[model samples]
Target: MCLLNLIVRLSYVDHTQDVSHTGRVVELKNYVRGLLLDSSGPLTKVELINHLQRLGVGYLFEEEIRTVLDAIWKGKDIEIENDLHATALRFRILRQNGYDASIDYFNSFIDEMGSFKACLCEDTKGLLSLYEASYLAFPGETRMDEAKAFAKRHLKDRKGKIDTRFEEQVDHAFELPIHYRMLRLEARWYIDMCEKDETMDPVILELAKLDYNILQASYQKDVQNGSFPTMYYRWWRQLGLVEKLPFIRDRWLECYLFSLSITYEPQYGYGREVLNKVNQMITLLDDTYDVYGTVEELELFTDAIDRWDTSAIKQLPEYMRTSFLALLNFGNDLGYDTLKDQGWDVIPCVGKLDEIARGDVPKSIQCYMHEANVSEAIAREHIRGIIDETWKEMNKEYVTDHVFPRAFADAAVGLAQRAECVYVNGDGFGRNQSNSEINGQVMSLVVEPIPINNV
Candidate 1:
């Protein structure tokens, strides 16, 4: 027969028993083994084919051999796991005898079938298969949008009356909460889209503004209804802003929850930045408490502050001198406090301030202290006061503009890194087209120029 026929016929016979089979099979196997032995770790399907051609296997079609090899390699119960493992085994053989027997026989079949898309689309269930493949191929926001757009178009074109329940379910999938407590989510998404996407359509800003108004209205209604206290506390807890307001014991858990969200969500830029500042504040507060306040006194103060009890501030132990000082500094920096006497929820603690000043207060606390404006002196004092000598040594100039800005920039960089890594794992279309498009949209939304006039 022909060379291909001879090779195929030889494959069925045991090499040990048949001299002719032994010679041909040994020669082909050695050739493949040698190719893999000399190279690096994993070769792609194309690389494997070219290597086979270079081996001078006249009868063996590289594509056909690749198909069989790939099947044997990827299958769990096979003698070898996959091409990488096969390549390793071949490498070992080459080191011993200057030949490799490892050849991927399944790649030829794949080449014959052409691209993954063509094979997927050739089936009778073309549309469903295509969608399923797309879902498997692209996930997260990219796939979600595609699926939503497809469903919306499909439903709109249908002549029959759509099932209202099914339609409601579809709408609910994309629905976001509109209450003031949750409006931050929408704001975050809008801000991220604006910053990250180069071609972010301006129309999205209109939607965001409308949503902001709705949330504001809801908040006002809740305030009038005397539900503001509960909702406000809950919001603080959920957004992790409560760590800065330690007196609010009822919402401590909520604060932790919000902190976790801030860590993960790139869209929560404002909240995230604020949370980092709050973390620094917390460290400073803790340091003050350790130096100037007893644990019992601090605990009691926390309870009193949450209750908005002005009198309890007077009852603070002699050791709890720095507690009120820290609180005052924090209030000044943030521009508002629940304890301000003029507000509806105010509880005047003026006398308590006198007691704190009597303690061993830092001079910077007196000079850099103001509620209206934060001077460079104040910023420097705060940074130096909190970061000890060791931490300063570990990361010199850690609080300078270069280092501090890293926290802010990390969200954008992290998103970009994740997108790039995920794209690398996928097909060319996903890598080149879909992921690039998504990244473009994200970058446009995040870094879009803000109109100075609007500000």
Candidate 2:
């Protein structure tokens, strides 16, 4: 980390005494709920709900949010032609929460010249909202592509005309759309922005900051004393992954940030530990396929994993043995815990990791292109289809009950979701140390706590 980044991060010091605002949290949730319920119109309600989500408080009132969105779904009273802000906000939030919102509604915003209406640029806030919403577009949504281009071009053109705060926000959003950002990190950013907005409720501002600080306190405690730093550090050194491979990422901090993003609640410390270790192992296997191993060696590794025998280690190359052994030990420990706690052995789940490994053994698109006897585009599509189907299973696990504890299950699904987010453009993790995005995440969520108000 640079000195400036280090200084900025360290500024968020831990408070000497822990802070808890249980009563105020209840009051704040009630206040937000009442506001959601009492909005004067559909547009107002949608806007309020969007604020709740962007502020990261919507999780506290899921049913209330669903109720309002349901009413809007039934009424369908939004005037896309007249009010672009409400229409875009409604479209984004509804689709994000799984409503059938379509980008086709933005047809009215385009002119005969096939560009967004020139006059619409004057509605800068609305344009920014539209830009944010365009990110939620699905495949084949050409109108959304146009909207993203139009909004981004105009937002950049008007940068100097906007206030510094708004300029800063526009730049940040342009770099990363909120749809792609983790919710808690967005909350940390928005809380500062909300402090400057005179219209925001002071109580909501206070509570959001407090909740953020308290959570940061818990995560920071883990940073200092958690098993992750001490144990993983020793293990990684012992495994000799860095010196041996020299290509894989040494990103324990970034991996833990991923764990926190999945389930940041304080009580899920064990879940974080488990997820972090799983992430490390996944990184090991991913590198072996994508970078280190040749086709024949990867075949051997995959076969050994499939056999699920202690003797399998002998079949692996000398460099692959320790990594494979570490993975097996993790499975053994995890399976034993599952048996003791849930009364079921997860050795089957452990065993199935080989099946997953086999799927990735092919590695590159070249393998798919040759094996499937399809064009490159078609081969890519097949992989995408697999990802989409996997999401359905992950989503099923997310909402329905399963053998794993709820928190661990959530973390498991979150790992999948975040992998999609990070790797959507490409195999970023494969690039390892040069990826600044994961490094920034480590700085924001794990290395730094949100600075709290002294009063």
- Output the number of the TM-score-best candidate: 2
Candidate 1 lDDT, tens digit per residue, 1-455?
Answer: 12223224323432232244335455545555454444333333323432332222212353454453454344333322333233333322221111222223223212353322233222222222122222111112243234324434443443144455433423332241111012133344444444343553333333333333332233333323434323433443444433554432222222222342334333443353344334334433444453545567767766555544345667676444344544544445444443353354322443233334323245443445554268766765574444323322222222224544544533333332332323332321213222443333322222222231231
lDDT of 2 at 206: 69
lDDT of 2 by residue, 1-455 (tens): 43235335545665565634656677677877788788468887887777777777777788898999898877766454478887788888877676767666677788998888999887888889899887666655667768888899889889889999888889878767776566777887888788788888787676676667666666666545535444555666787777877767676665766777798778888777887777777777777776788889988888877776779998889988877787788888899898999899777677566555446756657788998899988988888767645544443344444577755664565565566656766766655544787677666665655554632
Off by over 4 Å in 1: 1-266, 305-308, 317-455
The model with the greatest lDDT is 2
lDDT of 2: 0.72
Instruction: Give every collision pair in model 2.
Output: none
Per-prediction TM-score to the true structure, in the order listed? 0.20, 0.76
lDDT of each candidate versus the true structure: 0.35, 0.72
The TM-score obtained by model 1 is 0.20
